[model samples]
Target: MNLVLGIDGGGTSCRAALATLAGDIIGRGKSGPANIMTDLTGARHNIVEAARLAFVDAGKDSTMISATDAVLGLAGTNVGGYRQQLEAVLPFRRSLVESDAVIALNGALGERDGAIAIIGTGSIFMSRKGAAMQTIGGWGFMLGDLGGGARIGRDLLQEVLVAHDDIRPGSELTHAVMAHFGGDPREIVKFAAASKPADFGNFAPLVFDFAARGDSVGSRVIARAVGDVEEALDALKLEPDQILCLLGGLAALIAPQLSHRYRMMLRPPLQDALGGAVSMAARLFGAPKGGADG
Candidate 1:
């Protein structure tokens, strides 16, 4: 019973699916944060926990995880040597780690030639034209991740600080944002010094909320973010009629705001990242197996 494992590990949580070479799902499981770049040891623990839980869900011995081959599409894999590092410590018989964006694109477009913009807590854009794949961004919140929740939330904090200093005009959005930080710019400064991307990302919804109410600053922020998204799409060189998917937490919120050109190309994803991992596992590693127990 040779079965492949698919794991989608992200900053928030990780999901695992055990399936056959033919793409029949056997069992699935989930666990907490698996962002290897931020917490390698914790990610390792959660990755294995999720895999173990998948085996449990399948009513199989969790120890059999060591016998399984796996494909893990994970957040933070694009940074440094974390992919190889995480792979080295994984409990699988064999494992391949890829950036989270890869699985998202594959899941959305299946085998078709298309593109995806993953705009969640972080941002990354990718396109596949046959075998050639092009990716931009996904550098994480510090260096890049423009148009993502972290970026949006961080910008809101900045707007608050500047407005407090009288350097910029304050709007309802900024005023509300300041209260989110105890109404003290000093508290925002303190929080920023020790905050993770998720901490800032928690405020992203507020930006969209205010923007919807015609808050000037919120509108400006979202407009800038949309521009970044369009810029990335333009760089992908996707022609008209090519499928374009906007995935992740912000996808629905950002969709209608995109220019008509991009809006016309949008389509819903066919499956989630875990599904993509299993599909990729079959293509990358299970082709010869042609056989799976479940």
Candidate 2:
């Protein structure tokens, strides 16, 4: 029985899955962030630790199993030196490292060609055809990530502060946002200074809760985020009838709000992103370098 390991390393968390060639999941594990660009030492630690946990859960050992191949889908991995950084840490025979978005595309569409828009802490647009890849967004937290949770949270926070100062009409969001920051704007500012952008993004759930409860301001903010994702999808040049997969928390949650005419294009994946890594690893078992079709 061939055993393979698949890892999906993101800005916030790392997920590892151990599976057989036939796609039966033996066991799974998770750890901390694995984006090397953001935290190299921490990334290595998280990846190794997550792998070990997965091996243990699968009743195996990391060093003992000489798998035919492995695949790591990581965030913050561009097409340059950062890829090399990831290759240096994890131990594997035949390995391929790609952006987390690539794995997401694979997971959503299986082997079919299509596009995917992922909105979680951050958002990215990825379209793929076999080995060919094209990307539209995911510049980073500072200038880009327009429609992601961090963007939503940031805007909502500003509104909360503005409302507190009577610049805008107050809503339930003002109270929720204030409470999230311990009911102090100054403390919230300080926390903002020390937190990762994704940390802000995590607060989106609070906004969602309020929106679900009929908070007008919160509902509008989330609605705008939904529109932003759709605009990004439209920028991908997808045909009106082409199938588009919506992957990630925000996209899946807001699928119902999308126009009914476009509903036909929106399909959820059968498995999550880690499943993509597992499938990629399975192909690497017998695939020669630059030999097998991507």
Candidate 3:
């Protein structure tokens, strides 16, 4: 089939891009979650399903996937044994599995020596300097992910709780949070009891929006989150001229608020994770002739 496939599989969904060996993306499709740690079999199924759909989108039969070389960037692939397990089951001529973060870095930096901060429901920072690579703070939301959307949302809920108990003064933001729960502190309590990282992350945008409007509570929450981001970047010790790409859902909100130092280093991503997966695939296996990508 003289084609390649790029797959981006996360807890929420799996996205597949079908391209020629020459690097022109011809089709793309998405399917259900493909989190290997939690559900390896399901992840494999979804991955193949996404690939099949991509082929369909490109006006080819699903069977063409058997001849396609692919690179998949998937959540939980970094955990021991899971990546190999999924790799063995995928329906492709040659397939490589990499941590989701890797493809995102490639997508953002495009072989540049720099760093990336993915601030979504959770956050992680990564850097690549030639063959040397470093990672910081992708430890999930319970104890880590301090600078992520989930953490900011959790902080907001805590502020609401403290204000409700008279332990802290309430502000417009906190009061608004309380009002969200029908002005009942116990409702906040009930919601928090069952909330997941993304459940809390839902409130992250509100915090940043309030901060933009000069609300004290929102501003403080955002400031702390910004501090966490800066702390991670400081750990990387990036060079002055090296670019830093901010990605994920909260990136837009956090970009303007970064310190002058990082602001100077910031640049937009060169491509998205799917594009990166395709790029990696092209590099690992020779692309077809007549491609002008170079």
Cα RMSD to the true fold for all candidates: 2.9, 3.3, 3.0
Candidate 3 residues lying further than 4 Å off, grouped into runs, are 287-294
lDDT of 1 at 245: 95
Q: Name the weakest run of 10 consecutive residues (lDDT summed) in model 1.
A: 285-294
Task: Estimate candidate 3's alpha-carbon lDDT, on a 0 to 1 scale.
Answer: 0.90
Check candidate 3 and list the clashing pairs. none
RMSD of 2: 3.3
Using all chains and alpha carbons, the TM-scores for the candidates as numbered come to 0.90, 0.83, 0.94
Residue 272 in candidate 3, Cα distance off native in Å: 0.5
User: How many clashes show up per model?
Assistant: 0, 0, 0
Best by lDDT: 3
On TM-score, the leading prediction is: 3
**How far out, in Å, is residue 61 in model 1?**
3.6
Every candidate's lDDT:
0.88, 0.77, 0.90
Residue-level lDDT of model 3, residues 134-166, one tens digit each, is 999888989899889999999999998888889
Model 1 regions lying over 4 Å from their true place: 38-41, 181-183, 289-294
User: Which scores greater on lDDT, model 1 or model 2?
Assistant: 1
